[model samples]
Target: MSVSIDISGLSHERIHVVPSPLAELGMALHALSEPGHHPGLQGWATAVSTRLDPCLADRLCEADFLWRSTFSDVFAPFAGLPGQSTLPGATLAEELDQLDKLTDEQFVDAALEFTCQSTYSEPDRNLLADPAVQRRALDLAAARGPQQVKFTQRLLDEPPVVRAWLRKLLEDCDEAFFADTWARLSHQLAADARLKTDLLRRKGLAEALKALSGAVSLDESEQLITVDKITTGRTTTGSGGLVLVPTSLGWPHVMVLHRKGWQACITYPISAPGLTAPPTVEQLTRRMAALAHPVRMRLCRHLARGSYTTSELADAHGMTAPEISRHLSVLKKADLITTRRRGRYVQHQLDISVVSRLGSDFIEGVLR
Candidate 1:
């Protein structure tokens, strides 16, 4: 199965155009940047709590904080939490200490116990492999795909379904849609609850939702709505009521980009037994995979610093234009990077913003 979110070998720029549905799911799963207002998680939390083992669920929560910190500190600008740094030069022992001192033995034992049980969780096993499950997930994907694609086309294309949904949500001070959304997402969550839980936990679902809700509420309280273009992952918007975009694979919930940040919640759909895995190298050619090469990695690093034409990239790396073009071609095919045509030049730049959001979220959280 071709995983929509797969960009393993793609350049960062091309990765931006990742199917909006997949990107939306990715964003929603990690949209836990707020609390009660965390429509995404709250929508699916009940399902998660129901399907996932209590101990595993708790461990997942702990792991979320760990990964969120890791991504936020490593990536910088895209930090999801915002203002947070990776766990500073502290050892595992220290980490246990800062929170509540635990003996090295206790921490190690706890870690092993968590790793063992969660492996068998449903989502980890790939829910889409089951034909029935896959069909249901695909159905939801089909239902929402056209709408999401339309929304992605441009600001004006925002679908009525989304607009109406948002209007209802915004008018209801308590965000009643959250409950319905969660219930709707429950089917998918149940089918892939184990996997969804793992990914959400890994993405720091609990913390991100908490942080996001706080940001949205505070933004609303201060009337901080409407900012310049909001850019997340590779998607950018000028101005519009945020809409929760759905993924073809069916997500645990829905997520929408608001002027300030985001609004999200769990969405239950009928459990589909099968959906393909996230994108992978096996899905791309060896040439396309070259984007993950060392030379390519460095080139991306440079371009991410600032846009540079092919010639400039070659000169900086002491390589020929042809060589740079070869690398750029591979990167472009993988959707990891993109080139914009200037008056007299085409410039290249990195495109992996999904991971960057994780980084951004962390920074925001820690800084505050």
Candidate 2:
């Protein structure tokens, strides 16, 4: 439950806590370890919106659970903070409604909740206070399990106790152990991206090993971390990254390092999972390039889910009606999404088939 660490080299300066409310939700759910609590982060918010609150939809979607998990996996360990549990009744209701509806707005609202603003801005506070935002969140709550509202309210009221644990983890461990922990944490994060439910199951660990097996660094420098060794510790509440110590039975493991007096553990070999094939640097370059325009990337993710009317998609992204139409037109030209006119509305879907063809011909198209 505790460890000592000294990480003078790994300062918190390099650690950039995720600023998105949706990511906080992912971290929160991952912390809770419940499965399918909220639809995978990104487009699910938008998709959920279509189902839960038609009036409160927007097109400004965050990365889906999978994509957001990729980032959270990297950041959660370093950013681990103490957990406090407190939730306002109205806020909890709103959060659940967002989850049930899966509105793009849900992702924004959730990300905003835990995003490290450091100083609260009046504009930001006002946005949150908007009656439309509140109504939509309430609607989302209505769509979830019976106790969702209560649970959410409790969470908003207090941060979890895990932050103190992370601080303790950092203070007790050394640099080498810290690095190993980082790797373990990274692997756990990748597997988690594909994991649909929030439940921290043994299967998630198994999948992580499988992902690492593709490029196991047998190099003596990368410590030989056995599968059994990684599974021993109960993962902390907020971040999905595991915490372990050398055990006599089965396998050997150790705690990751953090700064002196800090209880945090750092892990390495950071990477994402569920790539159809291992990506080359070139492929990664292209993917990054594709995401240069935030709006375009958002559109691609929306299409990945299924065909939706332009209006339907627009509501999810938080865009003006005309803005949505313009983006769709651009995407169509890029061959990323295909559209069909359904009388009053034009529906669009991801052109994965085309993307596959493009990749085969050295013509990379987007939609990861």
Candidate 3:
């Protein structure tokens, strides 16, 4: 599944690289919620976890429905909230001020849109008014957890309260740690934006898009930029064009927002120096050991060509399914491979980028 962006009429001027404090804050909250998922930011997340005020932490836990959503639209820039700015640069203060200005109706709509559980259905503005749809949504949220159930209920029954609670939660987050976190990340984020802008200027759109991340690719013939994502959809740049926002906390996840009434934007991860720690000796040794086996080396070579199921790999290697599974597990543990579900089967593919970086990583580890 992938998001194919139609960029046929997109001009160089339409491509933007901006830093968003709002997006960063949302990602940071997500990282906080799932610290184990973001190993790169674990140290920083742990430190922040320690500093969080107990009340503020509890408030964030209540809003798990926001960050846990596939697309956290509430934090998305230009989400059509009243008084929200669509410009390239806006400080965290400015963004929060805009959030503060959201009417009860606007806030409820945005929250509902984010919390919508349907895969094929569009979010209804009058969803709360429809008893049947509201009950279905509530039931889905209830299955997830009590927090989501309470959040959905608040969004349905108490729009004003939900709006105020969200605003205060964000304000409290800034006061607790996001203020300092953004300060530390702002300079690096600005530098990454400038570098991307330069890449766009010199190499043009195709190369710039290709350089964005391994997950992004440009098909010149199709006039499309495809983002490897779990959700599949196609959207045009329209007259609003596309905005590329660089975020540090949003590592390992690239979010594409192409919702109606909002400018299309892609929030991608940017490397922030001195923030993420380098691989420790144990990590490097693990990677080396995973590749040391002759069978695993052959497996990597085969996976480089295309994704294969465990049985397919076993057949190719003249090995049993259990044997192939053990080798795959080692590679997976070392982050040398990735897996995706395809119907009833699971396909494993090589993480070529990580493998490509091994030599440099080894040299850096040695020098350090």
Top candidate when judged by lDDT against the true structure: 3
Reference-based lDDT, each prediction: 0.33, 0.34, 0.73
Q: Write the per-residue lDDT of candidate 3 for residues 1-368, one digit (tens) a residue.
A: 57777877778887788888888888888888755435678789889989887887887877765774344666864545432226543777777666656555545556654333423235444565778877877775554456667788878898867777777888789889999999999999999989999999998878877777888888988888898864567777766567888988877678787655556778888763232334666788899999999889888866754466787678667799999999999999998898987455687878755665577678889887
1-368 per-residue lDDT for model 1 (tens digits): 00011112222121111112223222232333222223334545455345554554454443342121111111111211222211211122222122223222222212221111111123233332344543433332232233322322221223334334322322231132233443455354334434443443455333322322222221323222221211122122222111212232232222222211211111222222222223333323332355459998777655543345787677667899999999888877766676786445576766534213333344444554
The residue ranges of model 3 lying beyond 4 angstroms of the native Cα positions read: 69-71, 81-85, 100-106, 109-125, 272-368
| Candidate structures ordered by lDDT, highest first | 3, 2, 1
Candidate 2 per-residue lDDT over residues 55-132, each given as its tens digit? 221211211222221222222222222221111112222323323332232223333322211111122433234665
Clashes of each: 81, 86, 0
Pairs clashing in candidate 3? none
Instruction: Point out the higher-scoring one by lDDT: 2 or 3.
Output: 3
lDDT of 1: 0.33
Ten-residue stretch with the least lDDT total in model 2: 244-253
Query: Where does candidate 1 stray beyond 4 Å?
Result: 1-277, 280-288, 354-368
Greater lDDT among 1 and 3 belongs to 3
- The TM-score values for the models, in the order shown, are 0.23, 0.28, 0.71
